[model samples]
Target: MSKYLFKSRLTPDGMKGLLSEGAKARREAVGRMVEDLGGRVEAMYWAFGDEDVYVTAELPGNTSAAAMGMVVSSVGGVRTTTVVLLSADEIDEAVRQEVHYRPPGG
Candidate 1:
């Protein structure tokens, strides 16, 4: 499984739904939706900033993450950007890899 971080902004309709449904219900709905996609929500937060919500979830892979993003975005009530989260070990592994490369201006 892999971790993903999602930052989202809700449209007016979505905000109205959230206010009506309450945060807990919405969180549960989100959890169920992710579970359907073979993922689980680690944490979901409602914030006061440019982004309305932040979500941390663990999914099978990029496919599941892409599906999640697509489904949410298709609703027309929310916009989200998802970033894949890698562990320190993954970064270390990446650092050990070597590839032939050329500088952009070289």
Candidate 2:
């Protein structure tokens, strides 16, 4: 399993639905969605900004995360951006690996 951060902006219909349903219902709905995707929501936040919600979750893999994003976006109720989270150890290990690369136009 891998951790992911999902950020989203609710569409007009999505916002209306959320307002009508209330917070607890929204959370439950999110929980159900995560379960359906074979993932777990670790944390969720509703915010006041360009993005309406931020979610942290554990997903089976990139495909699962991408599929969830696609479904949510296709609903016309939300737009999502999913990012894979890497651990500190993962970054350290990456630093130890050797690769040949050059900056574009360098």
Candidate 3:
């Protein structure tokens, strides 16, 4: 499994739903959705800024994450951006790889 970080902003309808259902209900609903995708929500938070919510989840892979984003966005409730999270060991492995590439106009 891989971890992901999601930043989201709620639409007007989503805000209405959140206000009616409450934050706890929203969290549980999100958890169920993640579980259905063979993942688990590690943490979720509501914030006051450019993004309304932040979620850290462990999922099977990028496909599951993209599916979640598409479903959520298509529902007209929330817009989400997903960031793949890498562990320290993963980063170490990545740094050890040799790449054959050059910068543009280099």
Candidate 4:
């Protein structure tokens, strides 16, 4: 399983639905959606800023993550930007194996 951070902003219409449904209900609904897609929601938050919602989840892979983002974005409610999260062990392993690449103009 891979983890990701999803930063989202709700559209005008989605804001209406959120106001009507309330926070807890919306969070639960999102959790259910993630589960249906074979993923697990780790954490979720609603904030007042450049973004409206933030979510952390563990998904099967990049394909699954992209699919979820596409589905949600297509609904015209939330727009998401996803960041893949890597653990310390994963980074350590990455540092061990490398491909050579010359710097531009080096």
TM for every model, in the order presented, reads 0.96, 0.91, 0.96, 0.95
Error of 4 at 68 (Å): 0.5
Model 1 clashing-pair count: 0
Q: Candidate 1: TM-score?
A: 0.96
Per residue, candidate 4 scores C-alpha lDDT tens digits across 1-106 of 9999999999998899999999899899989988988999999999999999999999999998999889999999889999999999999999999779999999
By TM-score, how accurate is candidate 3?
A: 0.96
Runs in model 1 deviating more than 4 A are none
Residue 24 in model 4: lDDT: 95
After superposition, candidate 2 runs with Cα above 4 Å error? none
Flag regions of model 4 displaced more than 4 Å: none
Error of 2 at 40 (Å): 1.0
Q: Write the candidate numbers in order of decreasing lDDT.
A: 3, 1, 4, 2
What tens digits encode model 2's per-residue C-alpha lDDT throughout 31-84?
888888888999999999999999999889999899989988998988999989
Q: Which predicted model would earn the best lDDT? A: 3
Q: In model 1, what are the clashing residue pairs, if there are any?
A: none
Candidate 2 Cα lDDT to native: 0.91
RMSD values, in order shown: 0.8, 1.3, 0.8, 0.9
Question: Where does candidate 4 have its weakest 10-residue lDDT segment?
Answer: 29-38
